[model samples]
Target: MARALDVKRLSLVRLALTSAVIVLALGGGRALAAEPERPASQPQPTPPVPAITRECQTPAGVKTAPIPLPNTLRALQQRKKIRILAIGGASTARSGPDRGGFQEVFERIIEGAIKGLDVEIVNRGVSGELVRDAKERLKVEVALTQPDMVLWQVGTSDALARVPAQEFETHVGDMVRWLRAHKVDVVLVGIQYTRSLAHDPSYQAIRRAVRRVAQREGVLRVGRYEATEALERVRQGRQPTPPDPFATTEGSYACVAQYLAQAVTLGLFARRVEPRRQRPPNPAPAPAPEMAPTPPRPLPLPPKGG
Candidate 1:
């Protein structure tokens, strides 16, 4: 009797398993495997960002103080355009990894950074030109182009030529003042830094002079020396390399351009304090007309009666 009960239970279990398999094979398998229906996702749109806000961010190893660019800002606001005259020595030359040159690269960056604004870069860079010579040429160029801003990359050649730092400062300061008088903005690009020349007095003096002039004149100054030194520090940390005395590389050029762009962007947004016009000392009240002596009137009346 126990054996019969065990066989009956085994038969019942087999029948149940067989039934489940048959049901799945028929249609339940398809139902279990099917994915639940879901609503289709709509594409999301990207928000537009202003060029000034987006591209004006300072990059690593670059820093600059904001200095007002009243003329350039006015040009941008009124004409939607800003003309830049890039004048300097060999560093400002049209030599870069990209044939477009660093000034061209600078132009592109400025235009991209400032939305709906056109940038015209007039490259007046002369290789081996000293600061004085460039200053003279700069005047002619300014007259011809009438640029809203003058990007002057100076001090490098002057320092190499051992020009007196005081003289360098005077010339730079004069040019900056002249540009301001002409309603043009000026940015002073300081001497390039190299490890070999880091301690050289003449080179360092010129660098200091550049800073002094920038401070006195209250114009934007791009401290290329600081920017390059910062880059050198970063590179040194990654892989120490022998210092090159004449280290004018395309990489450094691009890096300097980035520094310049940051300075220019900051300047563009700086507060403009217009110089107060001295109202001509209120014209001294014109002296009252001297009254012809009353005697003269009496004499005329007596003559008419006679």
Candidate 2:
């Protein structure tokens, strides 16, 4: 009787399994395999921009002090143009990597930097001329061209000629004053610095004179010698600043031009002087006082005596 009971229980369990299988098949297996739906993924945030650091900067050193260019600035505003007269020292030649020397490169730079402003550069550089010669002809050039500014490359020739520092200083100072008085701005470009000449008393003296004049006159001074020397020192790391500013490339001019452009920008935005008001011509001197009364009185007295 116990063995019969066990077989009935096994048959009931098999019937339950068969019923579950039939139900799964009737549901087509799709519902049994289906999974819960998932939400879409969100996008990632954009990265922040890098701060402008000095590391990648080209190491452009501090520009020369701001020199006031009232006339130049006024001309730029009133005429939308400025004329530049470039006069060079005795050895200020037009030889450089680019066919155009500093003046040409300089002109291009100013025009490009300040949109809508035209620059007319007159290259009157007299190669091998002395400082005194340049000073003498400066007035003539001003009268002829009527430039808004004069870019004087004055010291190299004077230095080469062994001109007295006092004399050189005087010439430069005089010209600077005269130019300013005439409503023309002047920028002095110093002598070229080289290693061999670094220790030379004459060259160094001339360089000092140029500096003094620039400071005294309150005009822009392009430190060609000083800048080139510093740059070469940086380039040849661990090497003593060479007696030669350059190794093989004629690239000093390009660098000078770049520095000059920096200085020009500084000068342009410097203190804005109101355009000078023109004074009306004085009224013609009152007609010379008539002497007729005195003459008539003398004639009458002579007739009465007769």
Per-residue accuracy of model 2 over 208-299 as CA lDDT, tens digit each: 99999888777899887777777666566545553333332345565677678767877877664677999999998898877765444444
lDDT of each: 0.77, 0.75
lDDT digits (tens) for residues 1-306 of candidate 1: 999999999999999999989988876766766957678977333223223232223346355677878889889878989899988865443433575545776777777777787999888887778877777778899999999999888889999889999988888888888889999999888887888789999999999999998888888888878876866665565455644565455666676676677678777776666789988887788999998766544444455557
Off by over 4 Å in 1: 1-61, 91-101, 237-244, 273-306
Q: For candidate 1, what is the lDDT?
A: 0.77
How far residue 190's Cα lies from its native spot in candidate 2, in Å, is 0.6
Error of 1 at 129 (Å): 1.1
What overall lDDT, based on C-alpha atoms, would model 2 receive against the true structure? 0.75
Best by TM-score: 1
TM-score of each: 0.66, 0.65
Spell out the clash pairs found in candidate 2. 90-128, 90-129, 195-243
